[model samples]
Target: MEYEKLVRGDVELWKRKLMKRSSLLNRTAKKAQTKMNGLIPEKANSVITESIKKMVQGALFGSEYLTKTKAVRAATLEELDKEVKEKLNFYKKAAAVEGAGTGGAGILLGLADFPLLLSIKMKYLFEVAALYGYDTKQYEERLFILYVFQLAFSSDQTRMETMDKIDHWETYKEDAEEIDWRVFQQEYRDYLDLVKLLQLVPGIGAIVGAYANYNLMDQLGETALNAYRLRWFNERENGQKQEKQSGL
Candidate 1:
């Protein structure tokens, strides 16, 4: 019970942080990205969008093959949280290593880091879903994973909209259209462009790549954990309400 209370408190605090207004730095960066986006040719934008869609589709299907099924034995939330944290540690190390290896190899290999890192992130999310006792094999669960990914990497305005969908996911999913791949790819690219560009530089690429990937994993891990926490609490509340209604 104490652990539950602590987790609830943490979730509340995370929610507050999530809903906060963007800092001046973030706004400025977004404006620059917008200008850059406008300068890109429409054909190139389309190509990039299609490429990202395929890459993400590949990761989604690939991760499903690798992800474990839901735990057979039920575990307490604290136990699940502990295990998830351990997995997050492993993933952060893995991402850092991958980033450094690619970065140190120069431009061509650095380009390879994009798909590799995306794969690692998606794989970790699949594992997290399983650890939280969800079946990633379900289509809706995989869709939820994408929502979590978008929430973690989008601009403040997009993040706010994504969060609202995540908060009311049960209702939203009933009529949810396929994700806008154009928006998905653009936002994701915009979020990582600066750091990833630094990763392509010759001399300091290794260090930059490692540090950036490690921190990116940290951010994704935290976002995934809290997103699940929100689901956990929501489900519990719904179950309680159902039981009370039945008792009446």
Candidate 2:
């Protein structure tokens, strides 16, 4: 009957695994920083400039680890079935103990807060990825959109109280780590409405919505990755533009 104790134990085990993963990530970042310093031309730039670039690179790689972190965090809290419950609840006097109650309150709090956390994670991940010569803006944007969709469906109230107190989607330089969950939800709602127009197609149903949502995400992610591949073209174009301006 004491499901809470069982769940807590499971969570503890999962936490240990997470901690190990985090340790490995930290070690990798440290090694990367070392490598970057060794490779950069020491005399070409000021110490501050070189240090900043290295820090940026470290942050970018750190963000890639966020993807794994998110997946692991979700798997750690999977719904408990009867078999899992039995295995977890080894404590005797099962009927004598009171249920700790549905984690509704906790879930509500997480739903309210997860979008903001996820946004921070995405931006940080993008920063880290960008350092490794990867353009992750599209992936970050798509993930942000997915987080918005999740926030919308997680709560019954269409209007979240948190929206009134916060702002969102400012330039990345302004508040890269902060996101207004309520505003994000409103944006997703608008996006969802636009996709609804596509539902008029003959074979499209609820699946149409699902396909649209994921298709946009896939496209965004692919765009971000593709930008890296086209970097040489971009550099050439920029060079030509600069030359034209100089000639003028």
- Model 1 per-residue lDDT tens digits across residues 1-248: 99999999999899889999889999999999989999999999999999999999999999989876464323688887888889999999999999999988999999999999999999999999888777787788888999999999999888999999888887788988889898899899999999999999999999999999999999999999999988888888888999999999
Please report the candidate that would top TM-score against the real structure: 1
| lDDT (Cα atoms) of all candidates against the true structure | 0.91, 0.35
Work out the TM-score per prediction.
0.96, 0.24
How far is 165's C-alpha from truth in model 2 (Å)? Answer: 30
Compose the digit string of candidate 2's lDDT tens values, residues 79-144.
313322232232111111211111122333323322332233244335323333333445444333
Q: Candidate 1 at 124: error in angstroms?
A: 0.2
Question: How many residue pairs clash in all the candidates, one count each?
Answer: 0, 6
Query: Considering summed lDDT, which 10 consecutive residues are worst modelled in model 1?
Result: 66-75
Worst 10 residues of 2 by lDDT: 94-103
Q: Which residue ranges in model 2 land beyond 4 Å of their true spot? A: 1-186, 192-216, 227-232, 240-248
